[model samples]
Target: MSSSSLTVQGLAKRYGEFVALAPTSLDVPAGEFLTLLGPSGSGKTTLLSLIAGLASPDEGAVRIGGADVTYRPPYERDLGMVFQNYALFPHMTIEDNIAFPLKMRKVGTAEAKARAAEALEMVRLPHVAKRFPRELSGGQQQRIALARCLVYRPSIILMDEPLGALDKKLREQMQLEIKRIHRELATTIIYVTHDQEEAMTMSDRICLMNAGQIEQLGAPGDLYFRPRTVFVADFLGESNLLPARVTAATGDTLDITLAGDAGTAQAIASGAVLAAGAQVTVMVRPQNVVVRSAVEGSGKLKGKLADVMVTGSLTKLYLDALAPGLPQLVAAYPTRSLSDEHRIGDLLELDWQAADAVAIADAKGH
Candidate 1:
């Protein structure tokens, strides 16, 4: 029943000649919901498996409550895991399925059943305790699986895309459920998913991994607003990266001239120090850009409107700068603001406040 913090020092893995995970160290305070986020083959799951003892690491140590657990077996590590697959027992009733972990440890039938009912109630599915897995909906089955994991009250829970099998609506619904349960239980949870939105919606902090290393790790807004690298900015969300040269550098601003454009732009550059004449990448989110006419004292980027894309509450304006090797830029506007008057081929001016953009050192080989 002890809810303990989890830690890792130099945890890494490899297969043959390739390194799947380089040496990495992280700490998850007790009761924190930490998410491992990355694209496929980015070592997020490999790190999770290492923490779960599902795979051995080439070099590293895992600690729980400040005690060494690197070499411990999964079951003995006091961790419960919920996989993308429901992994529920088809032949057993939901109650038995939830009670399996307790039963394995020689718990009495009465105690296991009581705890199983409690776990079901915790997941808001007490009524489905006696139903078979095949008889429940996918969401309900996943909830049951969650309940099964909680029955043992492990110190930490490792969830690997538990909602990956659900449709969008169901996945979103379950995200709220998982968030509510974490709030209620306050247990340390380490979740692994390729879905960035899910990580943003549910995690207290996000650890974004890539190429066997941590790309950028912080609160969702921190990573999105002030990315330290171009890769981090582009990966977190939609970005309109423009090449620029640092014409002048100050303590708070980096004045740069955009490639293929004559106007100079200023952006926040305190995060990464750059000297004058150094090349930088202007990191601007599509939503932060504004389409308008030429305005004094504003950095104007002129482009022709290429197309419009409407998704839910936002309208995206794709603009072509006609620059060689550069892709079309995008600016997102509120759906309500996009009227019939807007059309393609219109010469429009795009501008963004210097505070809204970050200047990252030009990443090579991107």
Candidate 2:
């Protein structure tokens, strides 16, 4: 299948006083698997709808392969959309459902049948072509829906939570299947999902949306490891957002004092300029934190261990008040490495390397 690049220049939408989508600009390279990820009502679906021409934008434009299509209807945009509820024809055989698109385009009967067969093969469901939609399971039906979309060979394919209706196991199974198909066909895909793990597993890049605007756009690792905003850090994964004050700035590193006497920690400045007394939040992942028996020095954060829970592969340790006024903190270790000597109410010290922490500006808390 052929693919083309997609670009959205200042695209936006609205409903009365509620801004469904803020003026947003995004460029998706050709053959890129891009996922629009966010919580509900974060403009991910709105953005996808605008790109698919399902909704007209209040301003800006949508371009496919550099061609203007902002005002075009959904069908004229050369895009295929797969929805959550596998929209298949119950009365039609699976082959006919896959071939229906080609029929509408007036392809010859022979060619439509050939393409339908080939599409079913692509989705690994060649044996089920003769079966009706009702005879197939949900996962099987969703595969048929995907086959129908692929048979058309549209320039771009948009998936709006196509796996939302599937069970967790089936959804995960389909995620891998979709990634394989994407690799095989090299089709440019713009997928929308509210599932964080789904976005992380499937996309070449993730465009994280919040409050009708794009919060962060980057590879999953970048967004997870070095987020530019607190919201990005908090939304993408579990993060320890410790309020702190910048004590000093030295090149790309910042020495900060944690609030509530939780001790000082050095963190990457991330190119942001801050003075000696600027308020910021230090973001640290739980896996990065190392907990040990409390020591005599004030170099590490001191807390009382509150709980220890094991979650198969990892053991999570919860601490109460790094100091008298700090919020709770959490640290995780491999379940196999957890020490049995540590007990609840034990005094503990938490520390992490400076490189594992990042200090972000205290803005955009909403």
Compared to the true structure, candidate 1 yields what TM-score? 0.95
Instruction: Check candidate 2 and list the clashing pairs.
Output: none
- Tell me the RMSD of model 1 versus the true structure: 2.0
Tens-digit lDDT track for model 2 on 1-366? 889999899988989999999999999999999999999999999999899888889999999998999998998889999999998989999999999999999999999999999999999999998899999999999999999999989989999999999999999999999999999999999999999999999999999999999999999998888888888888987778898888988876889899976798899864366667888888989999988899888677888989998988888889986576577899988888535667999999988988999888878431
Which candidate tops TM-score?
Answer: 2
lDDT of each: 0.87, 0.90
Where in model 2 is the C-alpha error above 4 Å? 337-339, 364-366
Question: Each model's number of backbone clashes?
Answer: 0, 0
**Candidate 2: lDDT of 334?**
85
- Kindly give the stretch of ten consecutive residues in candidate 1 with the minimal lDDT sum: 293-302
Q: What is candidate 1's lDDT per residue for 52-162, written digit by digit as tens?
A: 999998998999988899999998899999999999889999999999999999999999999999999999999987789999999999999999999999999999999
